[model samples]
Target: MRRPHPASRPAPQLRIKPPRQLIAESGADLEGHGLRRTMGLFQLVCFGVGAIVGTGIFVGLSDSVAKAGPAVVLSFALAAVTCVFTAFSFAELGGAIPVSGSSYSFAYATLGERTAFLVGWCLLLEYGVSVSAVAVGWSQYLNELLNSLVGWQLPDALSAGPGDGGVVNLPAVVVILLAATLLVRGVRESARATAAMAVLKIGILLLFLAIAFTAFQAGHLSPFATHGAGGVTAGASLAFFSYIGFDAITTAGEEVKNPRKNVPIAIMICIGLVTLLYCAVAVAAIGGLGADAVGDKPAALSLIVNQVTDSTVGGGVIAFGAVVAIASVVLAVMYGQTRILMSMSRDGLVPRVFERVSPKTATPAVNTWIVALVFAVPAAFASLDAVVNLTTIGTLAVMAVVNVAVVALRRSEPELKRSFRVPLYPASPILGVGFCLYLMYGTGWATWLQFAAFLVVGSLVYACYGRSRSRLVAPAAPGA
Candidate 1:
């Protein structure tokens, strides 16, 4: 018998059922010199490290130190443990799907269209708000570095967002625009830039940790749990958001070579490395400067370095690192946002404009710039705390959903090949979900209100645009 042409076979059983032309169209959009599958485990690991290590270690550390004292080390442990379990679930789904949109796409493929839309909406909140928050933090460092080096500073009104007294945050907007421009160019450039920035920031952290550890004293840790267990949990919840980017390593599923093996390894390895770095830095900073003092100085790392070495060089180095690190964080997070939009557009959950890739770059250029403006404008003037609080809630909610997805997929597709599996089956994912929910509860009433409001907005979007535009809504789905 004559061998059948590749196109003659039905699409994979697990494949999204749309027209063959639609499938081809979607595949074609991803082809060529765009954000193609050029990244391997190393590049992907750097992506995770770049995105996760920056804001958390730099700006957020002081608050965690204040809340838990030296016991912030324990808080890091708690957050890491929680993430590891979720990482396993992410690894399984990421490998099984190997598609764009990360969890949003996974949910759509397995959970259904409506849940997918909700996830996408939550992700928009998660990524968009996070970029705003991180960029604001970056602006602070940029302002500081400029003042120290040139004896000049941007006006407070100009440097911060609306609540911070500025009508608009000019620096945050500039950085967001810069990142958007890079993303629209190509993925390889974006990934390479991320890797370089990750190295500079992590190196600065190591320098600080090494210097601070030398001054570590046992007495500073005396009141390890001064505020008691409640404080530690509260601190853990706040710190939990700092670790948000660990899962970004898995987002490169389609691009990672041998994704099953490489993605899981990269996820676990990056998490372990980042956790160690965070715990060590927390311990050293608390031991040397005292937790209360660190909190008062939001730019604690730079302040501590200046005091320790009695020189501007140390502070300058960290400030430089902060600028690069936060920029990388914005890039990675924004990249994740565009990919989700790309998937949604293809699925007809968002406008077709989001699905259209520029032939020049093979990237969702239009979608990325649109999202950048949407996020950057608010970020320029908004308070960092507000953006962070909202993002934390959305991220934790999605992690909980992912934990459930892991167990459901295990049972529902028992024989399906998975590159990675949660080591302890139901218990691991259950514990992961539990930890995430507990943290979500700790985000306070205000955060919950913000999250609820966003969810309501999401529902309305789904009712209006998503449901009507959804590919599945058509009797025979058309190519996007």
Candidate 2:
């Protein structure tokens, strides 16, 4: 008896839609037609620094130092190496696509519709959580500054967020709302403000390195890898959060003139500049303040500067710089988040609320406020580690997708008129994937669990609303 094979049955029809076909159906265009390309290499570097040099440097330096001792320098280098690979992939994709949504747009073009949705979802965690985290970190430094200036400080209960021992993070919330207001005004204004802050931050970091180096003690270098190579790697993973925003320069590709040449140049310049700055600071701090001392204080660099010089002047300068720096971090990250949401709305992943631009401001007013409120509250009181960890995981996930996108695009669309191609093709992207994966593993299991929950919730939302409402799935009437 010949049994009928299961292969004889017809293949089931997929509820899934073709990705490219859907992209063609969506009326929204990715490229900006007439936007100004006013950003020069200097401005672009500032933009990258504005996004990258945030509370992470001001607050996270101590944490990393504590984890890896003098080896923290190696950690920064490890993180920078990982970032360089990802940055190259980003440069190639951003130049080719030049779209509003950075990774989300890339994933849609190469991966598929569902993968695109997932990428956007992960970004929400990256950008949204990070904004809140940065805001909260700002509040701490602000309080520190106030105490140093006056004899008094804000009540701890009022200063902190829900998890940090306070009922609410009033300062963080206020800063977020203020940033939202500024964003509602315009991108140019926001960028200008951010640029000023970036300058102050770089100045502060340089000053710290210079002063710390004056007190450098070679003896502190003894027992360098006290925590071993594994600990140093773990610290590097944590330090990766500091490098989060360099790719943001690419997100502005459509707005830049000569994006092909300028965008790639900006990414390399920005990464190189930041890495040099971080290395200088790390080496100086470890030399001046024993790695053991570095771990004992929250504001390690500032504390070391004060201890080395025994001057209130150093602390004042560092605190003021931190205030300016963190403010810019909030502004830049919120800008990135709103833009991501706008891109998603255009593609029908989320509600049209994300797409609504205020006639008064020409920005996404409602979306800005919504994002501000969501991030502000938690940022006020939660531990910086928790928020930063979430951001790192989300960013790693996005980077992984980008690595795949680079390879897939090459094989699938070999002649897509890419202004920049990631040199060494398969090898570069594979290295990028490996770097991001290693960092992703560094995040503890708790963060992974939270990330998983976020994805599951996002998937449900897409299934219930986004899938059906997708502009590409149900094409509009010809004359509607």
Against the true structure, what is each candidate's TM-score? 0.92, 0.92
* Overall local distance difference test of candidate 2: 0.79
For residues 1-480, could you state the per-residue lDDT of candidate 1 as single tens digits?
Answer: 998899998764432332223323334235421446677777888898887876767888777777777778888888888898898888887766566667786666566667778888888766777888888888988877886688688998889876877767889999999999998888888889988888887888899898888778888888788878877887887788779877766556555566657777888888888898888888888887888888777788888888888887778788888889989999998988887787788677778788777878777888988999898877876898767768888998888888887776666667766767778788999998998888888778888988999899999999898777666656324432
- Compared with the true structure, what per-residue lDDT tens digits does model 2 show for residues 1-480? 987799997885433333334233322233342233455666766777888888777888888888888888899999999899989999898777765677888888788767889888888777888888888878888887776677467887888865777777788888889999998887667777878888889888989888999999998978889899888877897888888888788666555556667777788888998999988888888899888887777677667877887976687678878888888888888878887887788777888788776766557788888888887767766767767888888999999889998998888778776778788878999999998888888887898998899889889988898889877667545643
By lDDT, the best candidate is 2
TM-score between model 1 and native: 0.92
- CA RMSD for every model? 6.9, 3.1
Poorest lDDT segment (10 consecutive residues) of candidate 2: 26-35
Off by over 4 Å in 2: 1-41, 476-480
